[model samples]
Target: MTVWILVTAALGAALSWLSCRFLVLPLLRRRGVMDRPSERSSHEVPVVRGGGLAVLSGFLPAAVLGMLGYGLASGEYGLRSLVTFDAPGFSVLAMGIAFGFIGLVDDLDSLSASTRLLAQVGVGIIFAAGVMLLLGVGFFAGAVIAVSVVYVVNAVNFMDGLNTLITGWTLVCALWFTLLGALTGSGSIAIAAVALALAAAAFLPFNTNPAQAFLGDVGSYAIGGATVALAWMSWAFGMPVVAVLAPFVVPAYDVLRTLIVRMYLGENIFQAHKSHLYQRMHQAGLSHETVARIHAGAALVCILASVPAVLTQGWAGELVAVSIWLLVLVFYSYGPRFVKEHRAKEHGSSSNNAGGRA
Candidate 1:
């Protein structure tokens, strides 16, 4: 069974890579679905966006098949296993795909912020209502979870100013969630995570610094929707909320900080701005790769923090995890200041070198 899952994951990654390299990129480039550089952009040149569709190409079929396979072997779905349309995994995948389509439309037509928010709200409510019906969650709790889903999706889209940041961050979270699923014996989640993780890995080479392509809104929407859906389901089923949220600490903190700062300054929160912590670091002369690695490392710390909390199931373990999160939040909040200092030092050294040569 494990071998089958592994094979499915490998196949998904391979297909995703091939699709992006040969199919999606070409089609997008030909159609001029490219992202142009602007004051808000990190890149100086345009690159093909909407490359995230490759993820669905690679993940959707593999995930559906894996779910079916698991259902058959475990007799979890009886004969209906072959047609998994009613399964939770299928529901999540379908919703993600739908959101990705909406993202693609935005990529082409550029939806207004209010319009996008309305769409997100509608989707969130429907998703939450579905969860209440299917998972037996109560109305109030489900509504809260729905709001979280909206936040996660937009948070991902907002923080996606740098090459490889969103893909890398999502990859880390997916892998962590995969591990958690395996530990909890939740086969559906484990399989879904495998598909997501590998798909992101396949997309990374093209998305890294000096990127050949970007995920655009399409990819971020899909990734964000799928991630929150899976985590919400896992939490509702049995997993602790802490374990589910641990991997997202960095992005969550960044989003919250961005919102608060914007509100305090009387700036509209929906406006496009490169004021994110990672963006500040990039503008301060940090390379895209450097910022990505830093964020990935921070994500790793959060993942590690989750392990003890999951293992101990005690207040002490949870407290320690929370403490680490708070500490990291403080560091991230002051990250811009450090970047400015580093940039100043670099500029000074360069000036001294030029003067010495003169």
Candidate 2:
């Protein structure tokens, strides 16, 4: 079964690659749509940036295949709740599409931040409503779902600077979910996890920094929506919040910490600036590609650290979460030193404060 799953992923990845090469990129380029590099951006050259459209080529078919396989195996007319398309599941898919469409338009026309945020709120409301429509669920669940959807959308977008930061973190989260599913023999969960894992893997090549393509709005928005949806479903299945959190704790904390600091410093948190710790590294003369790989590697370590939490139950999982979380706090405190050193070198003859505003 594992072998078959791997093979399926490989095929999906290959097809996805081709779709990016022939379909999405050509269309985007031919239409003269591309993100031009500027003084504020990292890339020195103009590269086609919306290649995230390729992810759908991988995500949709794999998810459908997972659904079909599960349904056939179960001999049921209704879709399997695990990986198949059902009411809430289809609603999740619709919200992703809506988010991606808004992002695609933003990439094309450079929409204002407020404009994008409004669209995001619309998508979030749809997602929250779907989750709230449970058999006996109530207003508390609806409130949680609404707040969570909005937070996930913005938080995930915050981590998307540099090359494959968001992509790498997403892959780590998906792989953790898949492993947990396999360990517990939850076929539906495993199927959903594997589908996401394959989609993220397929996106890796293009997303690596000096990224041949940026996730732009489409990639981050859709992936973030799907991730939050996954978390909501997982929590609904009686999993603890820690299990829902273990996969995202690092990226989530980074965003939250950054936001707190930015607010304290009187910065417009909504403004696009290279103040992110990772963005600082890129400004400190590190190549975009190097920064991407470093984030990816860090996410990989986080995934490894999550194994025990993913496999453990109850307080055991909480223990692992607490331990890894403290480590992230340390990283946040000292992580800027690496960037500061490089900044100091570039401006040896002048006084510059790159720590707060790179």
Candidate 3:
């Protein structure tokens, strides 16, 4: 089963990479589907957007193949049995496509924030209700899941400002989920995570500094929806909540802090702005690659720390996870100020040295 999953992932990665480099990129350029430079944008030139179509092209087929493989391996080949074999993973793929469609419309026609939010929430509710029905959870749990889906989808979109920031971070989290699933003997989680990782990996090359194409809202929304779905699936598999949530810690903190600061300063929270911690770090003189690598590194550290904690599974595990979370949060929160202060000190010392020479 593991071997089959690996083969599927490899094929998906190849297909995703080829489609992005050939079909998607050419179509976007031909159609002039470009993201132009703006005050809130990190890039200086227009780049082709909507590259997520390639990701979908790769991921959807792979997911279907994976589900079929799982069903056959389990000797449950009926349509109903296949759908129920891994309800959460199937739901993830379904909701991801729905969200991707919404993003595609927004990319082309530019939907208003209210409309987009409404659409997202509506889809989220359907997803939550489906999961609740399949898993036999309560209405309260379903409501919480719905809210979480909305939050995660938007948070991911918010964090997608920098080159390779969201893409790289997502790849890391997917890899972590894949490992967790393997460790826990959840083939569904492992297969789904592998497909997601491959899709992100295929997209990474184009998304690097001097990006040739952007994921646009389509990729971000699909990735976000898929991420939350996997987290829910992990929870259902009896993984510790902290472990399941570990991958989200960095992005969640950044998004929440940015929103709070914007609201406190009386800025329109819905307006586009380069106020995210990662964006500020770049504006503070760090290169886009530097800032992106930093975020990816932080996410990796948090995920790595979660392993032992998850395995331990108790107050001790919770303590480790919470402590790591707080530590990273403090670092990210104060990072910009620290950079500014250091630069100021350097300038002051240089001025004094010039005076002495004079």
Candidate 4:
């Protein structure tokens, strides 16, 4: 099983890198599928979009093979296990592909917000229904899951403004999920996590500073779908809820706060804006790489803080997780201001030194 997981991850990484480099990137360039600078764009020049197709291309085959290998090796089922709907991995893969399609369509021809929302809701409900049937949960729980799926999809999309911000963050979260899945003995979860981690890592080089391409809506939506699927699978396997949610604290806070502030200011909630905390950090003179690293570091901290919850699986663990979230929330809320003030103080100190020298 361990060897299978390793092989699956290696295959996924190789496929993702090769596809992105040789297939998707060149195709987008030839087709002129580019994103030009805009008011909300973090980049100054046009870059290739829809690079996420490579991620999906890499992840889909590896994920299917991984699950199939697991089933056959465990002697649990036959080849028909490939289409088994009960397997959480199947659901995860299905969601990623489904959402990726919607995003692809939107990327090629920008869809109306209402149209996109309706489509996402439809997919979310289907995914939630699958989860409900698998878990035998009630309709209300299914609805909650459905809503969470949609929210996460948009949350990830909303944070894709900066280069490697969402991609790197997703990699960090996926790595944590891989560990969690292994510890909990959830083969589906572990396999899915490993595939996701490697795919993201493979794509990271292309998306780093001076990004050669963007994930666009396709990559962000697909990543969001897979992420929520992994989280739900972890919970379905009985991991602590707090532990499951820890990695998401930073993005959730950024999205929710941005939405609330936009509403308060009477701005269009659906309108693109450079208001996210990470975006603000970039606006405040931090480089994209620095801002991305800061958010990734914060995510790592939240994941680590939630480790206690996985160990304890009780009130103590939940408390620790909640505390870490609160601390992170505070940091996100005031972090922009803090950065501005620190920069101001440094500027003032520099001025004083210059005056004394004069």
Best by TM-score: 4
Instruction: RMSD for all candidates, in order, please.
Output: 2.0, 5.5, 2.2, 1.4
Return the clash pairs for model 3, or none.
Answer: none
C-alpha RMSD (angstroms) for model 2: 5.5
Local accuracy of candidate 3 as per-residue lDDT tens digits, 64-172 = 7885687567763535744564445576687779899999999888999899999999998988887797679999999999999999999999898988888888889
- For candidate 2, write residues 276-349 as lDDT tens digits: 77777666677666766666665555555555655665677677767876776576546568677757777863
The local distance difference test score of each candidate is 0.82, 0.67, 0.84, 0.87
Considering lDDT, where higher is better, how would the candidates rank from best to worst? 4, 3, 1, 2
Q: Which ten residues in a row have the lowest lDDT in candidate 4?
A: 76-85
* Candidate 1's TM-score: 0.93
lDDT of 4: 0.87
The model with the greatest lDDT is: 4
TM-score of each: 0.93, 0.84, 0.93, 0.96
Instruction: Write the residue-wise lDDT of candidate 1 on 1-358 in tens digits.
Output: 4654686588779878999999999999999999999878998988998999898788887777787788778866544633544555666686678678879889999998788888888888988888888777688987897799889998888878888888898888888777776777767777777888888889999998789999999999988889888787667666776788887789988988878998999998766788888898888878888888888888888778777778887778788888888887788777778989978998999999999999
Clashes of each: 0, 0, 0, 0
